[model samples]
Target: MDPFFLYVYRKLKRKCTKELPSCSLCVRLGKTCDYDGAASEMNVDQQVLLDRIRELERQLEAGSGGGTIAEISAFPRQGSSLVNPTYTIHRQGFASNLYFLDPESFGPAGVPATELDPGMPVPEQVRFILGNRAEVETVTESYYDTIDRWFPIVSRKRLVARLTTFEPKTDASVALLLLCMKLVTQILPHDENPRTGLYWICHQFLMQVEGAPLLSLTLLQATALMAIYEIGHGIWPAAILTVGNAVRLGHIMGLHDRDNAHQLFRANSTLTGREEERRTWWGVVVLDRIVTMGTYDGSILTADVRNHELLPCTDSDWDSGNIAPFGHAFASDLTGIQIGHWAQVCQAAHALGCVQRHRVDEGHAKNSRLDEAQQLDRTLVSLAASLLADMKQRGDMAINDPKQTGSRSSVDAIALCCSARFLLYELYACNDGKSNISRVSSFPSGQEAVMQRISLQGINECVNIMHQIALRLLEPQQHSTRQSPESYITYHAGSIFVTHALYWAASECSWIVKEGINAAAARVMGDLVKALHLLNDRWHRAGDYIKLLEREETLSD
Candidate 1:
């Protein structure tokens, strides 16, 4: 009956049958019937770790006099089981560090094992539904061919390397990731979409893995892929919840600290796992912003990316498994910088966060935020310069590959950047705000009108940008060679990851049609909707996007 203990149980996701002394579940597990006693013992070891972390922090602060410069050394990373973990942290110069998450203490998992396959040769049920070994190989290859090129969250070579050491019956994390890859890549019937089949299997494994105290990069990648399924299918609330947990894991593992001054040159200065970690964090950030795009809500990426948060490593080097870091950070000066495709996507998502942040700003009137908007627009323009140039030379579909629209492998990044600018412009210009737009002006005159007029111009430019992207998506692919061949990937239109960009543009332009601002923009929305219809076969959420636009069209009519 003690609510505190009940809350703890709920936080740990244990269902208490309300049995006296110990809940039925606890009774079955032979644990103390909690709530009425010193139930804190349930997580006493976790507290010990926390207390040790605090002590370490205090010692670090006292030693470094509050400096954030970490002493770079060849110590083992957190979570490794060591009889004695060593960190040569004390150095000749300034030195200190903050442990976002200390490694898990050495112990078997508190919960039971969740065997995904449950057999040496893979269970008949799993093998029948998912596939046999060779079929699984095809599905896995398709995953890399389809989503991974754009999302680039999971490392294929790394996963193959890791799976080589994993036992088939065990290794739930890898299993979950593989299942998710199949769920997204393989075309299952509607009954097998979410709860009825593969999605359900992955969800159960995710719950088990997410519960067992939750520490593992493999699980993080697994969650991201599953959440992609959720977002792609328009599975609300659940999508956001999944992305939120992934963000939390990202923060806990210090994935967001890649370029942080405190975490620099750490991880033994070898890019061993750092490349995957860096790419995963960017994927996490992009997904966090993307889920909110469906509702035109604020981005969920709470981690403030600094100007120095280096963008993802070069695409070419990453694919070849080279460990060289990218040339430049998202450093404030983004002028004429030649970055990779995925880096552009990362920056676009980061800027979308900034654009969405404007909606939640309550300090000043919307008009007062014009300077912020202007600066953001300028930064976005600088980023889009190369993309626009590429589009100019090569028309809409840059490469012969259908999935790559704007400028080959950079299609999703181009889409995201266009949506960012479109939403930023529509934030001030569009009359409708509740649905597609982020905000509507309460005070609709004078300086507000001036801002709206300026936003209208920006919106037009965004429309022009959207037109090019739409043409790339809507127009048939040409067998031309004006642009270099994209041998790196060959993603078809059916494999585009998130339709957030296409959805966002259509939503805004639909309102532009309703308001009679630019009737020509209607064509652009139609083109985007057509593309979404083509993609609906793959994601199904594209259908949701089309339905929303149709509703608007109906209401306007």
Candidate 2:
């Protein structure tokens, strides 16, 4: 036996006070565990473990015992340190310090994790991950940039008139309506310039389309539900603006128009079948009316205070039985990108409303319709919470499913990243009394403490999810030579989403909760920014490649 092996064996023997064998790495690493292997293999493992242990020990000594190895290795498993001291195994003869571990080895039960193959060069593997992330970021940036650049140029008046000419059959009319809404919403926020008048003209043109059928109950319900979330977060201004537009459109189409508009609005209201949808729509309409009423009285929306629960989801009799279930027109799987818009709107509302909760039915005149709005708000919040929970559960199951043994699809990969970001926001935004309620009430000390706990939990989850995503994107899989460009694009987009989500979350925390985020979150944001810059460089390079390919084909022809 090698002398080192003999020394480790003696140490293990001394540590083994019972019949069960002791782990060599634990003994050498100065932790506790079980070891079952040849002495040389054990020695090799111990040396690796010892290197890490020594590094940690030095860190602890430098920090005057304030820093611990336990803190460094806190993730992937915390309490189980005694049983699974090292959850990962680095590839044999690989000089780099990267470790490959089964995703299942880390975290709470049922949380998702990604597995990495052991053969690839660690540096190349990391680059591969970064490349995918870069691609996603590039695509997202392009999408935003395109929207920003072309929006000012789009002729809203002509577009609205064009929209009016097409009286579509079936449920497609909602698409046109939504398009009109999108144009207005995007332009309305920046309407100070002279060019904004064109948007108003366009808005007027769309409003001229009488009896425009409310198509896609799913979309209306989704939008309404999102509005409720905003109201709950005390982002009354945006909630008012968005829902007010919907109400104005509904009323204009319902009451003022000469062409069967009232019948169409009635039909649309009746079509929403889900109890949740009915509640959300009613809540939005009632709230819109209340806000309008208050504005008419020259009072703030928050000035009125009544019990919101009086208006329950069941208050509406609008024949919700007629609404169809979600269909092919709506995207399946609820991509994070799609849901992201709703989250953004909700956050924007929160910022405008001073992060306060309000009583739903207080101070409204008789038949004020505020009760319906409150019910809708509650229902939408419940729906969002449920959706988030389901996504988390599904992600965990998908990761562990025996049949899902192959690499993840680009969509699924991106979805996972989005889901993680969603959870992070929930951690900061959801259930925080200070952030959730209206300004009339101050958060108690206990509530503040709870909010901090929730933020910490969310931060921990976000960091872990980010790590898993990074590993999956960067690390090589079996039988694949290099990651596809699509993978790069997806990863890049996902990283951008994560970066923006963090920035928004941090900003919200600083503004509402006053609980400063730790340095790690800031560090992660910095890394993501650097990653974006790198990705932009890659995108430019890829653009060159594409142009070269096109020119080559042209020359060949």
Candidate 3:
């Protein structure tokens, strides 16, 4: 693209004889050449392009040789815009900014001043987190059975081993235990306010051991779990901080550097230990992508980390009581059926990030962007196809099977598939810029009609899937029941999923209404409202959706 600009600049600068009021070149080409004050701005744009082109050429030349590329860095630092800055694309004619990767800060970090004032000993903290022996057994069982599948970083066997020892007061161990108990005590179907006290103590413990001298695998695991717990509770700022810390610690320990385990950790590290670290690192990436959805919070796991290794093993492989050496990449012998839903979620996230990076580098110029979006759409479709095929091959996890429907991981994989499709829709549909509710203003006839068609298809699929998810949320056996707190972290990604789809539908309601799709739009809205209402009983934030619908109704009235 830069080279093309340079070529145009060179052609424009060439001296040509004038014929009448126009330049000679214009006359020879039978075209108009009315250069005015705008020519100076064109020259400035050309100069910027030339500089960028030269830098890229230098990087290319270095890559051709033995040296590394000068432009691309393996590990970008925290808050570095170059890592992956949020790109804002203006709607061709609308007032709202179309953001691809907008940064989201949850505000200031730390617990209440008074809350941090008092510090209890590890023994008291342990007892506070777990009241009695029976309570300890219950919390442990609950976490392993219900919550662990989503982010299986902590080893149940290892944790049980630690518990058997006398008062193991490590920061990571304590943080992990506190967070698990907090989730169990808070998210279960009940109206108990007693556990918030335990949640605060856990927060205090995390703050106390935050700046410990040495970094351990356990600490990273704890930090990742803390982020997950905080995000589930709608504590965005704290979740952001903990996830950031976890990613930073991961980089320092070279967790993402492939095949460098011995160099970073103990020389005698077992295969199981190495595999555990890999899963934990990937878990952080999953949480990072999940929590940062819809906002421009730059992802903690950069492309560099993703390229470093293969995904973790299947649940069956991990659960089997066999010890074997794991490879640096996904095993070719393992069929797609063996890959877990969590791995599919990671792939979806990675694909979304790639699309975002492409958008940032290349502005929303219709021609190439449509092609790229379609290509990404194909890739995402292929991923979904693979997941479906895998599910069929397994037989037990059939798409419509009642048992599979209850599995949180299965639900998450399907939701993420919907998310990827919506991303494709948003990429192309954003530029239409028509916001008036009275007319079908976007994707007017004859302008990139192919893109408009693809985007419309994406929208249709997204809305349909949203309706399915809403129905699933009403199921009696879903993890987040009417009586339980909304555990958005586990299987309840529907909260964010529905909100995103609902906003997209509502924003375009005027256009759809004008196009005689009012009935469909109303149905989508009704389903979303029903799902959110189910959550509203226990999750305070769910009420926000109800209020949004009310405002829309008022506007209509």
In model 3, which runs have C-alpha deviations exceeding 4 angstroms?
1-123, 166-172, 179-185, 188-195, 259-264, 296-301, 304-308, 321-324, 327-337, 363-368, 389-408, 434-447, 477-515, 535-557
TM-score for candidate 1: 0.69
How many residue-pair clashes does candidate 3 contain? 4
- What digit string (tens of lDDT, one per residue) describes model 2 on residues 336-404? 432322222222222212112222223444223223323323333433344434434445223222122
For each candidate, the alpha-carbon lDDT, in order, equals 0.61, 0.32, 0.51
Task: For candidate 3, give the lDDT of residue 53.
Answer: 56
- Alpha-carbon lDDT of model 3: 0.51
Candidates sorted on lDDT, descending: 1, 3, 2
Worst 10 residues of 3 by lDDT: 94-103
TM-score of each: 0.69, 0.30, 0.64
**Per-residue accuracy of model 3 over 394-507 as CA lDDT, tens digit each:** 552444542333343454565566665765566556444552111223334454566667777777766655565565665543643435434433344333334444444444
RMSD of each: 13.9, 30.8, 23.9
Worst 10 residues of 2 by lDDT: 74-83
Residue 550 lDDT in candidate 2: 39
The runs of at least 3 residues in candidate 1 whose Cα sits more than 4 Å from the true structure, single-residue gaps closed, are 1-132, 188-193, 258-269, 296-299, 325-327, 365-368, 390-408, 430-446, 477-498, 507-522, 554-557
Question: After best superposition, candidate 3 residue 399: deviation in angstroms?
Answer: 6.2
Model 1: which ten-residue window has the lowest total lDDT?
A: 89-98
